[model samples]
Target: MDNNIFGYDHNNTWVHQLTGTSKLLFFILVSIIAMISYDVRFITLVLILSLIILYQSQIKWSQVRLIVKLILIFACLNLITVYIFSPGHGAYLYGTQHIILHLGYFTLTKEQLFYELNLALKYLVTVPISLVFLITTNPSEFSSSLNHIGVSYRLSYAVSLALRYIPDVQRDYQEISMAQQARGYELSKKGKFMTRIKGVSQILIPLILSSLDKIQVISQAMELRRFGKNKKRTWYMARKFSRNDYLTIVLAILIVLLGVWFMKIDGGRFFNPFK
Candidate 1:
C-alpha cells in the first residue's frame, strides 16, 4: 500500500476481484445520480453506502490519508465559497429562513446550514466509490473493460496509460520532495503552512519535466512496437463478468432508480422540509 499516492494496490478482497467495468460504471452512474439530486436523505444514504463499499474493500486510513486530507481541504474551500457567494440561496431553495445567527452581512439561517449540509454530503457522496474503483481496479483491465463496452481501443488505452502514469508521477513527486527536504527545504509539518506550500510549488517544475521525459520514453516504445497500427486490438487482461459483478451492477442500477424515485417524491430533487 503506497502511503503517499492513490493507485491500484492488489488486495485479496472480493471487491478487488470484481471486474473493472462494473466498478467503473458504478462510479460514473453513482456520481451522476449523486450530483443530480439535492435531497439530504438520498445523499446521506448514498454516502453511507459508498463508505460501506469502501469498508468492504478493506482499505486502511493510512493508505489514503494524504489524498483524503487534500480532498477535505478542497471541500472546506468549496463550502466557504458557496456561503460567500450565496448566503441566502439556501433559504430561497427550501422556501424558508429560520434565522440562527446574525453576523451582520451574513445572517445565519437553519435553511442555509441544512442546504450546506446537503451540499457537503453531495460533494462527499462519490468519494469512497471513486477510491474503490481507483485502488482496486487494474489499469490494463480497466482499459479492456472500456474497449469491451464499445470505446475505441486506442482511446481506452490512452485512459489506461493515464491511470498507469498517475502513480509513477506521484512517486516521482515523493522522491523530489524528499531530495528537496534533504537539501533543507521543508515540505513536512516541521515548516509553516505557506512555506510547505511554497516548497511543494518549487517541486512542480521538475515533476512536470520528469513526467514529460516518461511520456517521451513511453511514446517511443509504443511507436517502435507500432502500437495502434490496427483498427482494433485484443486485450490480454480482459476479465469476464462474474455473478458478483452482475449483482454489483444490478445494485448500482437499483441505487440510481432509488435516487430517481427520491427525486420524484421530493418533487424535483431538492427536498423541502419547510413545506
Candidate 2:
C-alpha cells in the first residue's frame, strides 16, 4: 500500500539500518541545535545534511505527498503571518534598516528579509529530518528502545500503538472511501471540489467509529493480559546498538556541539549580516 500516513516504510537502506534509539537521540539533539540558533551558514549546513539523510532513506515522494503539501502550506502561512505581524521586528533585531520596498505601512528591509530567510531555512532544516525520523523508525522497536532507556513500558507501548494506529487508520479510511465509491459516491478528481469534500466527511464518521471500537478492543485485551501490572518489563522488540548507531550518535553530538560553537562565534542567536 502506498501509505498516505507517516508510518515506517520498510526498506534496507543505511538510514534504516541504524537502531531506532540512535535515530531518536540524534533527532532530539539535532532539533535542539536547530531550534536555538539563527546562524545562516549553520542552519544551511543542517538543512543540507537533513536533505541528504532524507535522500539516503530512499523515501518516495508519493508516500510523503500529503504531508509535504501540508507542511508547505503551513510554513508559507506562518511566514506570511510573521511578516504581517512584525514588519519592523527584523530591523529592530539587526539594529539597521536598509529599505528595499515600500509596502505602505509595511516597509520591506534587508534585515526583515534576512530574518525571514533564516526562519524559512529553519523549516527546511527541521522538516526533512522530522519526516525521515517518522518514516524510517519502526514504531514497536522505537517503543522498546524507549523502555530500555528507562522510560515506562506502558507509556512507550502507548507511543508505539499511537504510531502504529496512524497507518491503520489511514488504511481504514481508504477502505471506507472505496466502499463509498461503490455506493455511488466518488471522491475522484472528476468530481467537484465541494462534492469531493462532502464525500470525505461522509467517510470520516465511520472511520472515527471504527477507530474508537479498535481502541476499546485493544485496551480490553491489554487489561485481560494484566499489562502494566509490573513497574518494569522486558521488550521483545528491543534493538541493540551497532557500530553504525554509535557513529551516527557521535555525529549528532558533534553537530550539536558545532551549533553551540556557532552561537558563541556569532555572539548571539541572530547572525546579523546587516551589522
Model 2 is weakest, by summed lDDT over 10 consecutive residues, at 1-10
TM-score of each: 0.93, 0.96
Error of 1 at 185 (Å): 3.5
Count of steric clashes across candidates, in order:
0, 0
Tens-digit lDDT string for candidate 1 (125-231): 87798888988999999998888888999999999999999889888988999999999998999799999999999999999998899899999999999999999
Expressed as tens digits, the lDDT of each residue in 147-235 for candidate 2 is: 76778889999999999998898899889999999999979998999999999999999999999999999999999999989988877
Q: lDDT, candidate 2, residue 230?
A: 90
Mind sharing the TM-score for model 2? 0.96
lDDT of 2: 0.90
Best by TM-score: 2
In model 1, the Cα lDDT at residue 216 comes to: 96
